[model samples]
Target: MFSKLVNPKSIAVIGASHNPAKIGYVVLKNLVSHNFKGDVYPVNPKGGEILGYRVYKNVEDLPEVDLAVITLPAELTLKVFEDTAKKAKFIIPIAGGFGETGKKGKEMEKYILEKAREHNARIVGPNTVGIYIPSTGVNTALVVPERSRFPGDGDIAFITQSGALGLLTMDSVSLYNVGFSAFINLGNRVDVNENELLEYFGKDEKSKVIIMYIESFKDGKEFMKIASQVTRKKPVVVLKAGRTSRGGKAASLHTGALGGNDAVADGAFKQVGVIRAYDEVELVDYARALAYGKPIMGDRIAVVTSAGGVGVVTTDYIESKEHGIGMKMASLDEKTKRKIKDEVVPFASVENPIDMTAQASDDDYDGVLEALQSDPNVDAILVYALFQTPLISEKLVDIITKWHRKGSKPLIVGSIGSNFTMKMAAKFEENKVPVYMSIERAVKAIKVLRIRGKYIERWENE
Candidate 1:
């Protein structure tokens, strides 16, 4: 099923056209632009030719097609599917107004399902953006931009219920120069749902982290079962929508999904060791961190900062004990405290949330980082603002880059100002250190990494 759907050697766009703004046209353009290595045929009743390729009147006229992408209207979608089923083994329907609408939609969905069974074919979505397989260079999305290229091969595989939202997230990650293994938009999931996809990606060698944006669940028990087993092996981060009653109802109409009890879903995810993201930005943050950063071993965090307020905020979040098992600020041992006092100025406070004060120099920052990194109790270290001044920022970047190259523990940085901070951020990114704009984001990222790391350890041991 996966090979025929994702690695197909030949494909047909059922509603292909020459109009650049049309969905079919964009799909064709994306394929050609991305240099997809496959036989592509355009099939449309009104089509003559598109992008120098001859267009067939219907799918039946195509010589050979392993996969068919239907970009026609709701009324004509089933007929297109039936025609394509004769030659293709997999069909991706990108139209709306299916089971998501109401009774009429359900009837329409039933017709498609019945026909698919008779033809021994599988359907991706009745309402979906489409799919992207980077390794195979197969892009089935109808809304892909003309300039869109296949994202680089990475360990993260993204699956989302909202087609547009999935594409937006993919674009955002690409801007950060992050790539993905594959992306699946499961809009109004009729034949293929989240559980099936999760199971598939769990065993996929190319996928190390699985990210999902879900509006509803079809089988809560089954989803929890698979999610628990999969997350034990790899990190699974979910951004679950429809928390409120109104939102749940809207979600149902949007994807023909059962939003179910929000609280129950939350508990289920937790029980299965899944990390739930509160918002879209956090979802990407968690996904990216898991993809790039090493997993944190414990919750005992040490804050080494030149910005006292930022250090305080980091302490507040780490000590709040709000996340999974609630992390705490590890106390500095007497030896480490003495080292900080000896290395730092007399006025500096030598505590767990060590405030090096504004007078901290390059040597002071290095001393504090070295002290924290050497401490046995400190599982993770948060470095805040070594670049308060121009001279200091440059020196701080040098120090951080050197230490980061040799560091084993997870080190996060929070910049104080925009201009200097941005440069420091780029350096830290180059050095492969994850930097955050706020202490809250840093703490959240740490929490997720720790939880996922524990799950991986347990799974490996089992």
Candidate 2:
């Protein structure tokens, strides 16, 4: 059903315009800038040229295309949809004021869905920012390139109900060296909904992990059924909005989504093996861990940090039961402890969280990580490589990267600072090492991996 939407052979912009402020103009610019390989047809009554492509005066005159992007008002979209319904296989209407507006808007949404069924065409939204597939260079998003950034081609497929929030969240995580296979914005959800897309992306080869920011499930039971099946193969993380009664009312007004009981939804999420994220940070953190880090097979974790304070707090997080994902500090082998203590200064802590102290050098981390990776008792390792120290250099990035690439076990790093620290963090991520800004986030990421691993382990044993 989403074949054309995923990889359209040809696209037609129905309301193509020359105005820089118009959404149509930005859509065309994105396609051209992203280097879309397919043919592009601009449809406008003006019958002129836009970005070097000739504009068709009418949709009827243009050849049948795989996708049609309607960038007009809700009322105007219906007239254009009537023309493109027979010509295009997939339609995207990027306009607001549809079902979210009230009774008149709901009627319009009903009409569009009826027409879509009649023509055997699928619609993405009547009020959406549209989709972005990095691999195919298909970017129909409404974001200004100057203000926001888009991720490169990667393993995560992100789906969201709110377009603006989706784009903003995508931008927020873009700097973390994570890439996206696709970005789908389901605006009012006139026709295409989350359950169908979840099933579609489940089979998508490029999407190793599927993440969503959902305001409400169009069909709760249907979603649970599909998500349960998908979770067996790959990780699915969701940040369900409208958890509070007041928040639910706001969600309805924002996107016409009817809110449900949060307690019931939480139970359903766990039943289906869906990892629930409470905020935007957890959403991306879990995704980064699942997408890049190795599967954690057990709950025992070893922490190696230069700062004693960081290691102490991280220990607290590991043993904390409030988060519900149980984990504990690994007891290192006597030989492993002796080796690490010998490699570093004699005073360096060789216990669970091996605090090498600020005086420890890059070589110290390199050797200690190797010891931890070889220890049979350690299921995962969290290292805090604070760059502000006198002995730690940028070379620590390469050392950590080499250890991570070995894939000996699940590894995550925590480095909290401003400019220089974030720079190294990005480098750590570029080398495929998951680095968190704080100890709490890194610990949470470890739990996420543990949850996903337990699911896989259960399925395998069954």
User: What is candidate 1's CA lDDT for residue 355?
Assistant: 77
State every prediction's TM-score relative to the real structure: 0.83, 0.94
**Most accurate candidate by TM-score:** 2
Off by over 4 Å in 1: 46-48, 134-136, 142-153, 173-175, 243-261, 321-326, 334-350, 355-371, 385-388, 392-406, 416-433, 453-462
Instruction: Tally clashes: model 1.
Output: 0
Per-model CA lDDT versus the true structure: 0.77, 0.88
Per-residue alpha-carbon lDDT of model 1 for 1-462, expressed as tens digits? 476777788889888878888888888887786678888999888868898788988777797677888888889887677767777788888999898889999999988888888888788888998898877777877654644434566677888999888887767555434567788888888888889899999998888789899988878799899998898777889999986454534664834355435877787887898988977778877876776677888878888876677777777788775532378888877878887788655567788688767777887778777776678887877777656543364778777656655776677666656765766665665555666666777788888788777876766677
RMSD vs true structure, all candidates: 5.3, 4.2
- Per residue, candidate 2 scores C-alpha lDDT tens digits across 1-462 of 687898999999989999989998999999999989999999889998999999999999989999999998888897877778989889999998889999999998898888888998889987899999999999999889999998888888989998888888889877766788899999999889999999999999889889999988899999999999999888999999885454544665734344435877888988899998988888888988898888899999999999999988888889879853468999999989999877656779888889988889998889898888789999998889899889899999999988888858889888889989988888877776789998788898899999888888887888
Checking candidate 1 for backbone clashes, the offending pairs are none
